[model samples]
Target: MDVKTKMRPQILLFGDSITEQSFRSGGWGAALADTYSRKADVIVRGYGGYNTRWALFLLHHIFAMDNRSAPVATTIFFGANDAALPGRNSERQNVPVEEYRDNLKKIVQHLQAISPTMIIALITPPPIDEKGRMEFARSLYGENTMKLPERTNEAAGVYAKQCIELAKDMGINSIDLWSKMQETDGWQKTFLSDGLHLTPEGNAVVHKEVVRVFSEAGLSAEDMPYDFPHHSIIDGKNPEKAFRVQCS
Candidate 1:
């Protein structure tokens, strides 16, 4: 590997569709990339529509035990799809609440085995607006074919609580997106584009929360140096000198 690549640390974002879309315009992952631009590489490994069970099956591949280049931090976000109601079309993604908690614990254990010192962040699933989600489902499957949303806020809340409690039990940082987004009135309209997905504003909220947690962990932007000197500070006649010194 090149000096630059070898020197730069990474932050891994692993989860389902919410994570897949995290690099979209005005998304939280994108914001993190920008925020840590030179300091770290934000690597996203999001599997759309995947739940904890499927994720467990693929975890070994995504985070190889032999890979010594472990990330400085990793965020495990799931449960949106897993919160699907029983007997619904989305039941395929549904995992029992206890299993969901166990899966999260296992994921953390796996990651720790890879990097004992790596910081781990657990993000609980956000709230779901059943009416809006059902409307979206109806639009896709036809009104007569779809009677209700596959996921509900109540069910999601249970999963989110389990996630938070597990994180606490493990002594890892946890982001309670479920409760934070709903702190204001009419969060469904303001934060969510669909009943489950985040709006641009919602993305901002997540970005802010991530920064807050990182800061609390003493990984503030100010504490981390940029990958290389800024253009304004680099010697115009010999930019390579700056790169060599910084990346060495």
Candidate 2:
């Protein structure tokens, strides 16, 4: 590790809905904050329906608020809403890959310019409804359910991989939570209780994996019991279905 990278990070977390939850909203951000509270100042800057472009806008918004000597660690987890299917209120989808990569790059350049020693960590967006959270939700909801375009698992996997590769090429520190969550037991089993979100238990699964990354990055945590709150937006428990939680 570079001596410069060892400095404490301000930990400005930016992303879409999952990362933007109540302090106790039972999502990964809260859990992560709990783990690293003693080690870093974890600031949450997440927006529910924001996409890559929206996040890029947010980076600039944050830059207006933060400057040199502001913070060190920066982690970004955007793209879930960006990849959302076009709908009544969702015009945020398939933002061009080149543009998406550029959006990230621009954020990185600005961070580097302001904080030359900042530990800017770019995270691949988490997994989506690879196991049919929507179909399961329909089954659970009956006619009361609204049908959404089936988001193919292939899309999420490919996009996440691309982002990881791009982050690596850009020389940003990265925590690949997508791969980490896939390896944890009974994790993917409940990864998505909804098509594009996670239940509390699902977030707990993710919380553990991300804290592991933080620990590896030299942040420490106090051990806590795992508490999972299951959401039924998308539902399934078959271990067989759970096994499909492979990460490419």
Candidate 3:
């Protein structure tokens, strides 16, 4: 590996579609990258439409136990597709709530095993808007699409509750997006682009919350040392003087 890359620590973002799209124009992942600019690298490992069950299979591959430099922090955001209604077309993605909780536990355990000191944060799925989902479905598949929304806010809330409880039981941080978004008036319209996915405004909320939790855990970017000296520190007459010094 290149010296520069090896020198920088990494913060990983792992999850489903929400994480995969987190680098969009106003994505939370992008916001974090900007916040952590020279401090640490933010790596995204998002698989769209994946549930906790399938995620188990990739843990060994994506986060090899033998890695010398594991991430300092990681966020696991999932449960959206797993909350899919059983009889719906998306039923294939549905995972029982009990199993969902257990799967999350396994993920946490695996990460902890890889790096006991690493920070892990669990993000609950956002609430659903039944009407918005119907409209979106019709737009994509026509009016003849299924009459009922494939997912419900109530169902998602159940998963969210489990996720938060698991975080507490395991002694880790958690972002209760499902409850937080609903606390705002008309969040159904302001936060979600489709009933299931986040809008830019929603992404902003996530960015804000993640930063808050990280800061509380002493991972504030402002307090972190940059990988190299600032440009101003370089002497134009002898720039090597700055580069030769130990990394900040």
Candidate 4:
């Protein structure tokens, strides 16, 4: 690496609560921030309870309102909220799967338009293995009446596989962390108490997976551990009363 050779620009990570945590409160975003030092500035634009439309809306805002003065590289994750119908806990698994793929493609297109050299990583959502959660989903949709499918680990898997295929078709970079996590002895060991979000250990796993992807892609970023302090779930929010980190 020539001293004169400019390092790749900072990575701009965009997504929902997951990415948001990496930025606003600090999770993988913080890990990347710490490991990369000043080489890259990871801008996390995250929103809780936001779907693909909202993520795209934020992306547009970043483009039209913020800096285009500097070029950007990115890593993206979404689809957790999209799988659920707006304002409803039931799986919007009803929405044509193709539409989900299209929304993400649009997001990718927007990133490309902003910076052709941008590297985007599409991470599949982590596993949701809460026994109570499945019942809750069933109750939310009254699916028992219709025999709607149980809270799906498959839906996220399907959506992510679609993204991987999309990336392949377009010749881009992505990491199927979701698939890999499935083999991690699962959420039983890594999840926060809530059973939805990740514990630091879980995020550490996510970090390692991201590192594997970036390093293999030959992106310039160091490999480091992902361990951030637990963030409080204040504001009387977060549905799961038991939801707080309990990492291994």
The TM-scores, one per candidate, come to 0.95, 0.71, 0.96, 0.71
Q: lDDT of all predictions, in order shown?
A: 0.90, 0.63, 0.94, 0.63
Q: Which digits, one per residue and each the tens of the lDDT, describe model 3 over residues 1-248?
A: 65766777789999999999999999999999999998999999999999999999999888999887789999999999999999997999999999999999999999999999898999999999999999899999998988988999999999999999999999999999999999999999999998888999999999999999998988999998878889999999998889887643
User: Can you tell me which runs of candidate 3 are displaced by over 4 Å?
Assistant: none
**Which candidate has the top score in lDDT?**
3
lDDT of 2 at 55: 74
Question: Residue 9 in candidate 4 has what lDDT?
Answer: 56
Q: Order candidates by lDDT, high to low.
A: 3, 1, 2, 4
Give lDDT: candidate 2, residue 13: 76
lDDT: worst 10-residue window of model 2: 224-233
Clashing pairs in 2: 9-73, 10-72, 193-234, 201-228, 201-229
| Steric clash pairs (candidate 3) | none
Error of 1 at 243 (Å): 4.9
lDDT of 2 by residue, 1-248 (tens): 43232343456777777777625578777777667654555788878877788677667668654544456566777666555544522444556556777787787888787777666666666666545665676677775654554354555566577678877897766766566566656554566666567778767765765666656665544442112222332246553443334211
Error of 4 at 175 (Å): 1.4
